[model samples]
Target: MGQVIYKERKNTNSTKWDDCLEKFGKEDLLPLWVADMDFEAPACVKEALQKYLDQGVFGYYKHSDGYEQAFMNWEASHHQYQVEKDWIRFAPGVVPAINWLLHILTNEGDPVLIMPPVYYPFKDALVNNHRTIVECPLIRRDTGYVMDYEGFEKSIVEQGVKLFVLCSPHNPVGRVWKEEELRKVMDICKKHQVYVISDEIHQDLEMSGYHHIPTATVGDYDEILVTLTAATKTFNLAACQNSIVIIPDAKLRERYDEYLTRIRISGGNSFGYIAVQSAYEEGAEWLKELLGIIEGNYRYLRETLEKELPKVWISNLEGTYLMWIDLGAYVRPEDMEKVVRDDCGLAVDYGAWFGSGENETFIRVNLATRRENIELAAERLIKAIK
Candidate 1:
């Protein structure tokens, strides 16, 4: 309903902007990479943080019941998933939780399963923990990306996969998985007695005409399911370093809690708790506005590129502010950096990073920015390709 006021993030130690040279080997390129938005955080989050700042007593803090209730209320209202307070866990971010869960649920050499062309961090979490990475690549179609259910099951069977990291409303590919698909995959995992950790950080950023379904509600696999999410992604509070880890089974929670205790990590900072609680309590309308902006940016980028580059294929953005585009028709994998970065002067997430080499020709663009930024990106992309 209200207009989103865009903010400049060029020199504020922003990862998506100021670190482009370090990350993409380029400087001053129009950055359309990374998942963080180019807008200021919701009013409620900022106001809450300011209120905390106004109180100069910055000491050791503990999470209040109100903090947990806010998240529980958000889950119930937003996704229709009723979460109990005891089922929740705390993490500074989802990636760390993934790594922690990997260590908690599986052995060092145990094989972990993941769909390729997914969130790159899933691979990092698996490999960094000395786990065998098992790849079951998602099958890409005209409509969008879909699961290879048969391949998934076969990989789980052959590799003896004990942990499966799922990206619901998958990153880079931008496919908000349907209920039936979730059921099928969970059923397979249930059959194999595999533990699943669904990275749902992007759970709240669905585009118009789309709804995000929390994977925990899909089936009776709570004993083996761990849902990781964060208000940081939804409310642009990533710097707050706070995330929610929901484990329905008491035994699994106990195991995760033991790992946390062993590592001497208890919870996040006071700012993270205050910001997240405020966001879940009063940021609904702000989110509604942000989603509309993302959808508009996606439509503009798609129409501009599709009209100019006939072979360019932009995947339908069902959820998240990320867009996956195939520039293979115009550029080869070997020249992706040259065409996209050197020639077009744009910093983007290379598709190869999301997978091995199957997606070498694709590029993932972040659409959670000003419309003018998207327009500039479109113009640069079309010019470089043509």
Candidate 2:
């Protein structure tokens, strides 16, 4: 394994750093917002991109058989789930795929259910497409967040939810849902005949002592489940805009393909195709190293906050680099930004954005930066809250 190094992204048009001032209205703040990492992409991805550039021909391109094989092989090798190539469909990104599903699968005024304090985009996709937003917020326990099984089922039946979007290894409050948990969800949806779309972009970033279960690989969900994932999040290749949608049922695949055709998203870009293939085939070691850094950062932040700010509660990091911390004890909900940004000079995702009225005092911190930045951010937070 090679040593992981961090670089300065301040002037490089990075959304996480360079665009922070404009987005957050705070200049010179340490940005731990957004999900992308400050670390460089895996060597394999960069080398592959360079190779494509060297070809000197950037014409419209089509993915070869090998392109799809890389994804199939990666899933089987890393996740222990085997998927056929024909079941795979290319999406430029995950969020776009969600919007497409909204247009193709459901109609205006139809109800779509999502676990709240989950990914914010799930709600946006539903509302932006003129569908009803059904919220079944996850239950917060001492252990971490879990599904409200009774409430979830009740909402589905009561609201007449046509589609359910699941965030496995759920975001904001990380919890790599166990196999049993996933099975229960699948069984419930199967009973209710509610279609599901699993957003598994964070599947490969699980911590040690935990495993992520692919929603499609669970019990009896072939017809009702569709999965959306991407190497962009896994390997920090988001700028390339590549993601995969796996639909196993033939009729569902036909409908999805027709939507893609209608929207003129016929094929993938050249750079994204090459980058994903290289990442899936040769980036395993890089991923392992990256996860180690993220875990180390999580531990550092958790311990530092516990010792320095006793009343603040930091959620467990089961998966993903995002840290969800409750700052209610130290600052009022309305003053969260003032303390974290204006006072501490730190830019983080305010909890209010995840859900309008809940967890307003919580803030999400990105833990994929160098150790020094994490330490500095912790120090500033301690000072600000005091």
In terms of lDDT, the best-performing candidate is 1
| Candidate 2 regions with alpha-carbon error over 4 angstroms | 1-3
In order, candidate lDDTs are 0.91, 0.90
- Model 1 clash count equals 0
Clashes of each: 0, 0
> What is the number of residue pairs that collide in model 2?
0
Task: Write one digit per residue (lDDT tens) for candidate 2, span 1-386.
Answer: 36456888998989999887798987788999999998888888889889889989998897778789999999999999899988999899999999998887889999999988988988888878999999989888875888899998899999998999999889989999999889998899999988999999999999999899898887879888899999999888899999999999999999999998888888779899999999899989889999999999999999999998999888889999999999888799889878888988998999998986658999999999999999999999998788
TM-scores of all candidate predictions against the true structure: 0.98, 0.98
Tell me the tens digit of each residue's lDDT in model 1 across 1-386.
36466999999999999998899887999998888999998888888989889988999998789999999999999999999999999999999899899889999999999999988989998889999999999998996889999999999998899989999889988898999999999999998899999999999989878899999898889888999999999999999999999998999999998999999999889999999999999999999899989998999899989888978987899999999999988898999999999998999999999996659999999998999999999988888888
Q: How much does candidate 2 score in TM-score?
A: 0.98
Pairs in steric clash, model 2: none
